[model samples]
Each structure stands twice: as C-alpha cells, then as structure tokens.
Target: MEQSLYLKTAISAVRAAEKIIRRYWDDGFDVRLKADESPVTEADIEAERAIRQVIQEQFPSHGFYGEEMGSIRRDAEYSWLIDPIDGTKSFIRRTPFFSTQVALMKGNQIILGVSNAPLYGEMAWAEKGHGAFMNGHPVRVGKVTTLNNAALSLGNIKTLAQGTGWQGLGKIVSGVNRTRGYGDFCHYHMLAAGQVDLVIESDLNILDVAALSVIVEEAGGVITSLDGRQLGLEAKNVLAAATPELHELAREYLRVN
Candidate 1:
C-alpha cells in the first residue's frame, strides 16, 4: 500500500481506539496488573482490539505489534505498531495525557504515524517525507541551537537516575534554560509542535515511541536513544531535540565516558 493510505489507515485506527478509550473513561473499568506489574485495564485491551480491527480490514497481510496484544506476523515487510493507551496511569488518574498511538513500519522504517489524544483535543499525523501536522495545521520544531537557551522536558527520571548517565543528565539539566517533566505522549507532541526544544526519557517501549519518533522527525526534529543510537524496536531511552546541533550537544552531555 502507498504511504498516504497507510497514514489514513493509521489515523482511522487511532480514532477507533479513541472511541473505545473514551467510553471506558466515561464509565469506570477495572485495572489489573501484568506479570511485569504494569497496570492494565479493559480500556487498554478493548481499544487495542478496535485499532487492530480497523487496520486488519485495510491490510490483512500486514503484521501487528501492540501493547495489549502480543506480536503477530512481526517479521512481515509491512507491520503496524499500536499503543491503545500510551499513558495508562495518567488515563486511570482521569488525566488527558493518554493517547492512541499507531504507526506503519515498512520493513525497518516507519513510514507513517498517527497519535490521537482525544480528551486533550489534539491529533498529530505524518507520512514519510510529507512533514508533520497537528490538528490539520503544519508544525515544526523550534530553532534553539544552544543548551543554555533551550527548554528541556524529562520523563522517567527515576529510571534515569539508576543508570550510569545520571551525572551526565544532571549537567544537561543544569545547563538548560528550563526543564519540565511532561512525561509520555505530551512531551513528544510538545516537541513536534515547537512548544519545547528537547525531550529526554529513560524508560519506554517501542510501542510507546514508534509513532512519536516519526512525528518528531517529520516535524524537522531529531529523535534517538539517549546514547545517540538510531531508534529501533529495541530502543528504550529517548533523546529528541529541535535541531541537529541541540541533539548533538545533549547527546554529548548524556554520553558516559
């Protein structure tokens, strides 16, 4: 399928998931814990099922990797990544930070993405080489080139403190003009829309960031692992910035000798 079609499908899937999520938001749902001890709810399961149904109708041959459902045909040339509720904890807390994340990956490259935060009333989408959009308006990253003048956002700081890069992160934090902990989809959306200059996260899964990575890059920003590696399925940490110079500087500060 073409990139445009993939983007459309992703957007539709996100909307479908959003409906399910909102329904559970209005009504209450029971939360459960996975073996890993992360929270899960019927909203998560049902929303992911809704997303998969929408995508499956469009591309039955494509593979799927979802936060709620395990991998399906993960090795297929075309695969869809889904996170029905990217911030489940926030969702359970009645916050608007949760979002439905969907991305189409052709081989190892993400070609399209759609992130919908229904309660937040924001939807961002992008097709490879087509740039990025938030609520139908084109968006781009900020132009802050230096750390001293840039605003930074942090996520999962507790996990980051346990790593060897803690001191490095501290240096970057001290140098930045301002820092905020806007965890999960919020920071990525803010970065893509030029509201923030940088975002750093120490703990996340591919499902949490696949769609976000595409949005940031398409918006003229750079996103990679904290150590400056290319984003992949195995990526857990993130270091996204508005410009290449800012990204490199942050990477240098976060680099462990």
Candidate 2:
C-alpha cells in the first residue's frame, strides 16, 4: 500500500479509538492492573480493539502492536503501534492530559504517527518528511538552544529517583532553567507544538512512544533513547529536545557514568 493510504488508515483508526475513549471518559469506569501494576480501563481495551479492527479490516497484511493486545505478525514489513490511552493513569484520575496514540512503522522506520488528545481538542499527526501538524497547522519545536535556558519536562519523579536513571535525572534538573512534570505522551505533543524544550521519561514501551518519536522529529526536534542513540521499540527511557544542541546537552546529563 502507498504511504498515504496507510497514513489515512492510521488517522481513521485513532479517531475511532478516540470516540470509544471519550464515551467513557468522565462517567466512571472499571480499572484493572496489568502485570506491571499500571492501570488499565475498559476504555483502553475497547479503544485498542476498535483501532485494531479498523486497521485489520483494511490492511490485513500489515502487523499490529498495541498496549492492550500484544503483537500480531510483528515481524511484517509494515506494522501499526497503538497506545489506546497513552496516559491511563491520568484518564482514571479524570485528568484531561491523557491521549490516544497511533503510529505506522514501515520496516524499521515510522512512516506516520498521530496523537489524538480527546479532551484537549488537539490532534497532532506526522508523515515521514512531511513535517508535523497540530489541528491541521504546522508546528515546530521551541528555539531554546541551551540547557541553562531550557524548560525540562519529566514524568514520575519518584520513579526516576528509584531507577537507574536517578543520577541522570539529577543532572538534568540541576542544569535546566525550569522543570515541570507534564508527564506522558502529552509532553511530546507539547514539544511538537513548540511549547516545551525538553522531555525525559523512564520506563515506557513502544506503544507508549512510537507515535511521539515521529511527531517530535517531524516537528523539528530530536527524539531518541537517553543514551543519544536512534530510538527503537525496545527503548525504555527517552530524551526529546528542541534541537540537536539541546539534545546533546541533555544526552550528556542523562548519560550513565
């Protein structure tokens, strides 16, 4: 299939998922804990199911990797990655920052990505080499070139403090001009919108960040593992920044010594 065909399919899939998610957003829903103790809701499962069904119906040959459902034909040349609700914790807490994320990977490259923010009324999507867009307007990363002037964003501080990334976290916090906890996929969307300069997070799967990586990069920012390497599905930590200069500085701070 052509890239455009896949991109349109992904957009339709996430939008379908978003409808399912919004229907259950504020009415109180049951939550369960996965093996990692992360919160999962009916919205998450149903949203993913709807997305998978939509994608599969149109492109049966393509693969799928989603948070709610595991891999299917994962080694195929083309695959879709879905995080039905990227911040289910926030969703359960009635916070509006949660979003539905989707990405299409053509071989090793992410060809298209979308982050649909149901409550925020923002939809960020990107096609490889075509740039990123928010609500149909092109967006770019901020112009903060130096860490001393950069606003650093983070996920759960406690999780950072207890993990192997604690030292790097300390380095980053000490170097940045300001720090905020905008946690989850929204921070990357914010980065793509040019509202944020840097975002660091520990412990995430491919479904949590594959779409974000493409969106951020197409928005003229850098997205990679904490070690400053190319991002991949296996990456657990992330460092996304507005520029290569800032990304390098962040990489230095996040480096394990």
Candidate 3:
C-alpha cells in the first residue's frame, strides 16, 4: 500500500504542533511533574492536542501512541508515535532544547518521521527507501568510523547510573569520544543529521523513540535498544549510532555491564 499520504499528514501534524509550541514558548505556564517525575506543562498538552487533532481529522483510522493522552487504536499495524513536546523541562525553563516529534510505524518498522524543534529552528525528516533530510536538504551521517573519534549524545546520566549501576554506565561512557546532552528525541535526529554520532538513553516512552528512529535510519544509522534488540513499542532504553559497528560496541557493554 502507498503511504505517501501519511507522510503529508505526518508533516502537517508536526507543523501544527510546532505552532502550538511556539505560542507557549516564552510565555509562563504552570509547570508540574508527572507521576514518573517527568516535567509536563501546558505547552505539552496544547501541542499534543494540536497534533492529535490533525491526525484524527486526516487519518481517523490510524493509531496513536502519545505521551500525554496514552494509546488509541493501538492494534493497527500502521500507527503514529508522538511526543508533542519532547523537552518539557527545557520548555518550562524557556530554554532552547524542546522539540516536537512525529513518527509513522508499520508493524515493527518505522517508515517515516519528522522532528521539529522550534527553539533551534530545525526540522529533520525521512521516509523509508528515501534519504533523510534536514530543512529540505539531504543530510547524511558523519564518517566517524571509530568510537574513540565519535561524538555522543546522552540524557540524564543519573538515570542510567541508578537503573544500571555505574559499572554499566561507565563502560558505555568510556567507549566514546565526547558526550553532549541534547533534547529528548532530538538527539536521534542529530545522529541522522550528522550533528552527533551516538546517543544512548534510558526510560523513554514509545512516543519519544518511534518517530526519531526513521530519521536516524534514513540518515544511515541504526536505532536499537541498548542491548542491540530491535525497536519495540514498549521499549524504554535506547542507544542509536551512525554505524552498526559502533552500535554493537556500545550495546555489548550495556548488555554485559
């Protein structure tokens, strides 16, 4: 079945969500924490609502796994993975790290994705069988062959350490060149866009990793769990890289640590 139509809908959802986020961008919103201790604000709710509205209007039969609203039509093979506002804490602080992520998944595979970070004025998108692009220009992963020369992106070392212990986190950290923190799902886009070489994070919702997976893979990278497993709807940990060799090197450590 042709899915180009879904691409248009995915793009629209991201753009609509971007506008919603931009409105709340420096305006003060009541900030609070979710049950999982993650930040949530009005921007997140409005962005998700805007994106969901478009998705429902355009593809009512499609499924959605969203951060704020939970799951709907989830049994469908083709579904959307959405994180309306990825960096809620950053958005709350009026920092420039938050972004909106939308991904289309067919069964276990991600076919297309778009991530818009209004604060950074960037958009990364890709469709399966076609190359990835950034702001309409084709983007490719870097030539960082060796882990020692590769740059890395990570979120919350504290979580990694607490969940897997320092031995696990240390093995993975020491194997890379340098690690920089990026927004929730933006790190994967950076990998696909060649802005970063590697990213590993723990405790992510499906809405956080799904759409970003296609962006990375289309940019010539691999997106998998830290243990080298295939991406899953219920997955919570991820480590993506520009090359499979680097991915395995990191995955090995995380697995046995």
Q: Considering every candidate listed, which one attains the maximal TM-score?
A: 1
Across 93-112, the per-residue lDDT of candidate 1 in tens digits comes to: 99999899998899999888
Measured against the true structure, the TM-scores of the candidates, in listed sequence, are 0.97, 0.93, 0.90
* 12-123: candidate 2 lDDT, tens digit per residue: 8889998888789756699989998888999999999999998999999999888989899989999999899988988988888888899999898887898899897888
Candidate no. 1 TM-score: 0.97
Which runs of model 1 end up more than 4 angstroms from their true locations? Answer: 1-3
Which residue window of length 10 is worst by lDDT in model 3?
163-172
Whole-model lDDT, model 1? 0.90
Q: What lDDT would each prediction earn against the true structure? A: 0.90, 0.86, 0.79
Scored against the true structure, residue 235 in model 1 reaches a CA lDDT of: 86
Residue-level lDDT of model 3, residues 1-257, one tens digit each, is 24377778888888998777777764667887899888898888888888889988988888988899888988898888889888787777778777788988888788888888878888888899888888888888887767788898887556667765457557657867887888586677778878899888886766777777878888899888766777887777788888888777777667623
Off by over 4 Å in 3: 1-3, 163-165
* Best first by lDDT, ranked: 1, 2, 3
